[model samples]
Target: MPNNKPVNGQKTPSFFDLIDQTPPPPVLELDSKPGTRRLAKLRAAWKASWEEGGFLYQRWEEVLQARHGSWHEVATWIKAAALFGGLSLIVMMVDAAGDIASATLKGLSAAPATGAGDGGGLWGTVAHPVQVFLADQAAHLAVAPAALYAFWQLAGLLGLIGGFLGNAGPRITWVLFGIGTLATIWSAAPAGGRAAATGLAALMWALASIFALRGLTLRPIVHNHPPQYQFNAALHLHATIPAPTPASDDFGDETDNIHPLQR
Candidate 1:
């Protein structure tokens, strides 16, 4: 964004006011998975989350920038997708190889222990429960990477690509969450009361839900307030207040700084 401040005589709304005015992105309530119509659910979740400002999005953006300076560029994200695909293939190959090695070792051990005839091959090997179990587990292990790539990892990549250009949503979401959290704590003051305990419990549940499942984190009640109000009232405490720069005397005077420790 350019640094053109509003000219004189033009009033500008504060960030919080803008947050109150802005509507969250559209969302789908269904659960999602790969190759299903439910995939729309993932799209909705990411869109909604990207819109709601928070520290999580900031950290992810930092990571994206630090590793790939051009993270904001489409070409960079595509390259990332390619790298992830290559790694997934390598992981799948290794998993399959390990399964094969384990099966071979187990088969050799079983053959000697059981003395159940030599080289009868597939049927003979599967005749043992141990072999059957290994084969079944191997089947699962073999497909694990491919499944993760097709579903979760691929979904994450898409989310990154389609993410909001700014962190405004998460920022506003967190700001509201912070105000609600402080109010909750203040109301629950006096250490060991039922109100305090109850508030704490709700806070934990709300946090777990917010982290495990993405969405707006705060809900309070009023005639025309947002949806956060419909849920637990006192549960959203998070922030990003920048620290002030150090003054010369913020630390003890340097004149006597070295003497005390040495003495």
Candidate 2:
């Protein structure tokens, strides 16, 4: 330690003053290290996901507690089923639309040839091409049927969404599903495997329709409510009694009746 005495009326250096004079330690650049930045980003993402998941879990817990014995759980499952069914319908619709588009484009590309080398009038030319295009569309039997199927699928998807949001009644969804199931079964080939697969699909559609109807019916009844509590008479009986006041000579027995035991 250096000498602490002041020289020539100079003020003595305190411990804090000495600390202030000390140089700060060099700060290491953690970001300069390989993989440090990537690790930090991953950690931040994980922390955010964890927080979000915890929040969702807490909300789910609250819902379960508030609606413990209600039909809410059944309704939730039905909605989930409807969502999955809608996804399937969407996929089928996309496939059908693709087929229709491809067929239509092929017919149009070949349309000019059908009207070529004709000495007919302008009306004849237009009429001839339209007829040819219709004939071409008729040749691909699958296209028309696919278009119809796609339309029904779209209708069913819309009904499912609308019913889920309470914008449409359950009957509409049920009707669409019923139509889709019938069409699916009707279109099934007589072949063994194909018929079996189509039958399975129709069964699924029927089940979805039933669940959708039930879910919509229960929607109004399956809502959250404040927890109900009943008054506990037994708890009131077990409550602690008040202590008795001490008898005063000046106010003899003035408070004796206030205590239940003394009374």
* Model 2 accuracy (lDDT, Cα): 0.51
Q: Find the 10 residues in a row with the least total lDDT in model 2.
A: 122-131
TM-score result, candidate 1: 0.19
User: Which digits, one per residue and each the tens of the lDDT, describe model 1 over residues 34-142?
Assistant: 4443344444444543543422343356466666555455344457877899999999999999998667545544443223223144323322222222334447675
Best by TM-score: 2
Error of 2 at 82 (Å): 37
Best by lDDT: 2
**Clashing residue pairs in candidate 2, if any?**
none
Summarize candidate 2's per-residue lDDT along 1-263 as a digit string, tens digits. 23244535764443334334434333367546546654555454434423423323333454566555554653354457668999999999999999986776556554443443252553333233333344455476654533433444456666665655555564676576666554544443234544454555566566666545545555456678877986656643567889999756754457654655553
TM-scores vs. true structure, each candidate: 0.19, 0.25
Q: Any runs in candidate 2 off by more than 4 Å, and if so which?
A: 1-146, 167-170, 214-263
Model 1 poorest 10 in a row by lDDT: 123-132
Error of 2 at 53 (Å): 52
